[model samples]
Target: MRALIVRHEHVTEPGLVGDRLAEHGYRLTTVTVVPEPRHHAPDVPFDFPDAADWDLIVSLGAPWSVYDHAAVGSWIDGELALLRKAHHLGVPVLGVCFGAQALTTALGGSVEAAPRPEIGWTEIETDLPALVPPGPWFQWHYDRCVLPPGAVELARNAVCTQAFRVGRSLGVQFHPEITTAMVRGWLGLGGAEQCVRHGVDPHALLAHSRAMEADARANTRLLVDGFLEQVANTTA
Candidate 1:
């Protein structure tokens, strides 16, 4: 089986999700939507590969908002179109954070700026705990998904909707793919300033992420297993 990994920014990587996919006998192909030079502000025209060609698609997080059409509208428009096409073709998608917001918009939902940004680790309430585990999940988003019609919300928190399912696709607002290294990379790339703005210490966040590494990996594995057995197989 083949999995198409859509990375929105250079700093973001597949992390444990890719590891789990490989363990499940999936060959991964990554497509970086916004590469190095264009990382900060993506303005170039880009297109996604045919959704029918891949067995699965995993859309990674981004620093940009889905509603920022003025700055990133050019490529985000294409991404929304691609996500819609993938859904229509019954291609399974696992959208994380910004990717989830994009999926929501593509599926006839809406994205809006949250009253407050959710950063660091948080425990969420879930209707389907077996499929979507509660808490200690890493979150770093300033927006929320209103949920597409027919989408079943699996989990939520005081701040935002954490996870949802629509047909074969699953969207999660938290970063289940987070690692200490990834957090460090994000911090280096202006994330530190964002943390300061939110009154969070970047160093402390990194340390906490390091402490949660082992448990995070285990949780991610369970999530991937649940997704394959529950979501993907049922849709198939």
Candidate 2:
């Protein structure tokens, strides 16, 4: 099978999700939205590839809001178009964080700023315990997604909708694909300010992340495996 990963920035790799896809014998191809020179910048080229070319699609997180086209450049439009096209084609999508917001937007839902940013380990209510871990997934987003049309919400917190599914597509508000090095890079790149702004202790975030490393990676693998299995069943 083939998987196309739409990577928004250099930091947001597919991580354990990619590893599990590889385990499932998926040929992974990444389409980096932002050019190397503008890796940190929100500006990304708007062009999109044919969704029909891939067996599965995984859209990674971004720092920008789905509605912030002015800041994100033309990529927002392209992403929305891609999501809609994928939906029509019944292509499975696994969207994370900003990517989740993108899925909601493409499916006639809305994205908005949460009352406050969620930054660190949090316990969310989930209906699918088999598919989602209960707590301590790395999180760093100020925005939240509305459940899209035909979507089944799987998890949530008092602040936002945490995870949802529509047909073969799944969207999660947390970063299941995060690694310790990825978290450190985010922290070193001034992400600490956001944590501080959100009343999250940087030390606590790091500590909790370290404590949850084994569980987090295992959960990532499970979710990826679940997603790929669903993809297989759909095409069977």
Segments of candidate 2 deviating more than 4 angstroms: 230-236
Cα lDDT computed for each candidate against the true fold: 0.90, 0.83
Tens-place lDDT digits, model 1, residues 164-199:
999889999999989899999999999999999999
Q: Which candidate number would show the highest TM-score if scored against the true structure?
A: 1
Q: Could you tell me the lDDT of residue 160 within candidate 2?
A: 92
Model 2: which ten-residue window has the lowest total lDDT? Answer: 227-236
Q: lDDT score, residue 25, model 2?
A: 81
Residue-wise C-alpha lDDT for candidate 2, range 1-236, written one tens digit per residue: 88899998777788888887887788999988886578567675557888888888899998788888778988788888998898889888889999899999999999988998888878789887777767667788989987777888888989999988887899999999888777887887778887887687877788778888899888888777666565335422
Q: Can you tell me which runs of candidate 1 are displaced by over 4 Å?
A: 234-236
How badly does each model clash, as a count of residue pairs?
A: 0, 0
TM-score of each: 0.97, 0.93
